[model samples]
Target chain A: MDLHQLWTIVSTPDNVPIVLLLFVVPFYAWYGLRQAFANDRLIAQLEGNPEMAKTHHRKIQPFKAGWTREVHVWPYLLRIEFLAAIIVTVILMVWSITLNAPLEEPSNPTLTMNPSKAPWYFLGLQEMLVYFDPWIAGVVMPSLIIVGLMVIPYIDANPLGNGYYTYKQRKFSILTFIFGFIVLWVSMIVIGTLIRGPGWMWFWPGTTWDHNRLIFEVNRDLPDLFGIAGRAGKIIFGAVVVGAYFLAAAVLIHKLITKTAFNRKIYARMSVLQYVTMQVFLIIMLSLPVKILARQLFRIKYVWVTPWFNI
Target chain B: MPETNGNDGKPAPPAAPAAGNGNGAGNGGKVAAVVAGAKAVKTRAVEEMKGAIKAPEKTDLWKSVLRVKHDETPRSRALGVLSNVFLHLHPAKVNRDAVAYNYTWGMGGMTFYVYITLVFTGTLLMFYYHPSKVVAFRDILYLDSDVPFGKLLRNMHRWGAHLMVIMVELHMFRVFLTGSYKKPREFNWVVGVLLLVLTLLLSFTGYLLPDDQLGFWAVTVGTNMARATPLLGHGGPFGPQMGMTPFNDVRFGLLGGSIVDSNALLRAYIWHCVAIPIIASAFMVVHFWRVRKDGGISGPAPVVLESEIKEPRKI
Candidate 1:
């Protein structure tokens, strides 16, 4: 594929992290090279003669910039701005040359692409939106997760492992995070692609939910009919679902191996193991699960009912 | 103090006069012991110096400062500059194993670099970026269409930002995969988690500034999604029925009305351009600060600094 098509795919939903990866490889290479050839010339000078070295900035040759001493300083972030300038200049030239890439048929407000994916980076969420309504899929889950993410530093009061923690020291939370991240992401992709359009529908129909549709139809309709009980059930169900998965793995193992009476510990341990294992399975299943899911969703050309959100 | 027989050419001690008092030789022994002790301390320090340079990020700032004279290389300047508050604060060395992840692979370091690149290009973009979405896209268009390096800087920052988000997510994935979010580091992990949220918020808010059709819908869908949660008895599914809470009207509150109007744009602009950056920066400071305070970024395996772990001297 030529650069234009490549850029579009990079900018849009392929669920591949090539764009970020591409940027990073060069960055670290530069980092390592700078570390090897580059001396902390400024730092060294500063120390060699702190008072007299106020003259270190002048040490840089006027155009010694043939290839080095690159770094950026702003927003309080110190990066290889000087080197970055060169790379960016080159990339920009290339991008500008390819900027003429034809825009896909103008996005018609009325006619939506069958599976109009979100900007590739956001396909994670677009992938999520499919499983949820505009509210849950699009907003609440992301908001909560993001908000929860914000609270992590505050809630994590431990001061032990800054750089690294031992195996035994970091068991529960690590496993939980991995399990939760995978389950949430993968499940969302599933719902977005697989569950989003058993029938194309929306979460709310003017403030009222049509419960009948959720069972035979897509999950978007489920939100419209969200009764207090159902919402509560979902919250509890999530816990149960997690707990049950753990339960399944263990009890199954116990049943197969040693016939022992089940207890809370057994159940909890089994459930935890089960969830973690499932997460691994899930992770392996799809490096870009959203893409696979999205393509699948788009493949279905016919729908019995039109979705309210309508692409 | 015993005087040897004059059989050999050995000098006789003053044993005849002060043989009973062993103070003279004792003083000499004490002096020798002191010299050995001092030598030991110096040796230990040199070893510590070597270890510090090898992994500068783990070394204390002042110690690293004291040790700089030893690092005679010119390239270390960049690595040295990394620790500069105003420059790249990368440690003199990094532990690769620390950044590896089992889940989504090694996205942590990549994301950090993404942030670095974003910060780099962002400064350039800020030179000409207007906070007004009304004119934000126009300004960007002008940068691309007219300004010599405007499009370059804009594209760099834009792509860099996107790369940052992806990297951050991947970082989180790596952290998860490797189970790095364990107990002791949980606190830092939590802070990192906040940083990630800030990253996402920063991105979402930024999308609105472009004011393109795509940008508008992205915000629309994002805000509407907020109404889905079971929070504060608002519009979330469980809340009271029709038009219950004022905030329940997701479309109205999120967009400052029923549509993605100018107000929404302004809010997004302020958030993306000003508010979010400030908040993220604050957290980043705390995050890095904690890295020093907390176990100082775990080094691979338990390799003790030879200087600090010197063997006892011969008796």
Candidate 2:
């Protein structure tokens, strides 16, 4: 029950659980090395039938494989990943017992716990929700992230190399998702400390974000989208923009007799891919700018608010 | 396309001049045909490779599933499973695929490998880890420094738990940027998301096992989050609102467990140590099987380096 007893038990060398893992890890490592070496030899022998060696088909041709060559993985990656994981584990274990986070109590519920937080690992998840609505942070964003992860193999089109891609291949998407996340959270934390005037993001007439009500707003706001005037305005404006697009074309066609070097048939065919790309880009850009413009352009900018980080 | 006839210069087997001749390019359109012909052969070759490598499905009565056959020694049995189903988890099977930059090893293998370690070490810890605060913390300490293999077991469990989270996330990231979920596999993506949530829950619940101050308060915070989830917690519909699921209500009914104490400990223990593992593992098998179904081992299609590819000779 005392700290000394705890230390003694933990420090003792004979502990079954800890010792077993130690042996098992090296055992696995040895097994890995042996397998790697044997595979090297096996591959050399199988070089006469390169196809058979390349694929994992169980069928073996017992021909006299007289011709031979050497091929093996250089700087084996599996070994590295395994080693990294092991190193991380050893570090975490050492840290767990060695580093105590200023322990407060023996877990008495009667006494209020101060600054209670989840384990360090789950903190990432909790921290993530700060940028998103509750439904999104708590549910949808994590869900989308996982779903997006699962489908990566099917989605990416870079051919030639299969499993050899690195962390940087799709850095834009990753950085966007992560930065969007951190910004969402850091914005709240900073705003929580500083911004406080009226509405969650607004100082009475001006609109922005308030840190405290972020979770509540996100979790609560989206569902009420169409039911409220604010949400209806978004829908209405979105509809109008789309409608205006088609109407503008109709007017342009009526007002001007447009001609091109190509015939009408070629013009329509040539323009399709370009049109789609432009439309997609336009839709994404239109969202916030339209919102700001619709606000009657009367709002003053807060010196600290980055437009993207605005809310 | 054909060699000149001894009597007259003409293509032989005109119906299919290239079909049975060397230098069949003399035939009409033969250059285009020959180039296209090589591509056709390659496509078939890939299909052939696929046919050869396809793991026999369980439905095949003739070919039994690869299993840890009982007759083998414990080590062989272990190796056998390790080579096949568990092969991806460990680092033993590196080949050309290992360094193929596009063939990067994702966290799937690491996740499962750590999982294997956890199972190996967890089963051992169950022999020593008590679920109660009265003895749980002490028992863990005893395992750490007292038991002959205690340190290894504890580290394995501890490290395995920690690594599983990291690897799963890496696995998620690998899957994501690769755009693997684009087509014919969206539902599996959903399943994977569920698996992610399950993994987080597993980690959260498992953290409560030690009963130390850190573990204790972690559960308090986590359970508090659960309570805030609109249904079960002390402040929820059941408390102020009176909402509780069958899994919790019937289970914890006898004990008026408002806080993360003994009753909460048992609930978390069942989830952490028992229920989650069984479910997560079953789902893992499904995950593996589905991968096989969706097309085993997804990544970019193989691109043999031009330096490595050889030009076949004309027969």
Top TM-score prediction, candidate number: 1
lDDT of 1 by residue, B103-145 (tens): 1233544565566666776667667667664466676677667
- Residues A1-311 of candidate 2: C-alpha lDDT, one tens digit per residue: 34553344334322222333335433433443343334334433455566755763211212234522111221255456567568655755674455332222355666543334455445434543334323323433444445544444333322222322322223333343344323332333333322222222333212332334432322222213334345445455445545675555444432321233212222233234434443333232232233333332533221112212122
TM per candidate comes to 0.51, 0.47
Fraction of true contacts retained by every candidate, in order, equals: 0.17, 0.19
lDDT of 2 by residue, B1-315 (tens): 112221242222233435534545466557756765655455555544444455333223324565434343545444553556535443322333333433334467567767877777778888897777677777777776799867766655665575576556546545644445534455566677677778878877777777766677756655544443333433333333465653454224423375567776777788877898899988888887677567545544232321242332333
Q: Which stretches of candidate 2 lie over 4 Å from their true place?
A: A1-105, A128-311, B1-95, B98-102, B149-152, B183-188, B230-256, B300-315
lDDT string, candidate 1, A52-171, tens digits:
444333222232435333332221122333444455456544654544311233223354344443444454577654334454455554655665554443343222222232222233
- Model 2 residue A21 lDDT score: 33
What C-alpha lDDT does candidate 2 achieve relative to the native structure?
0.47
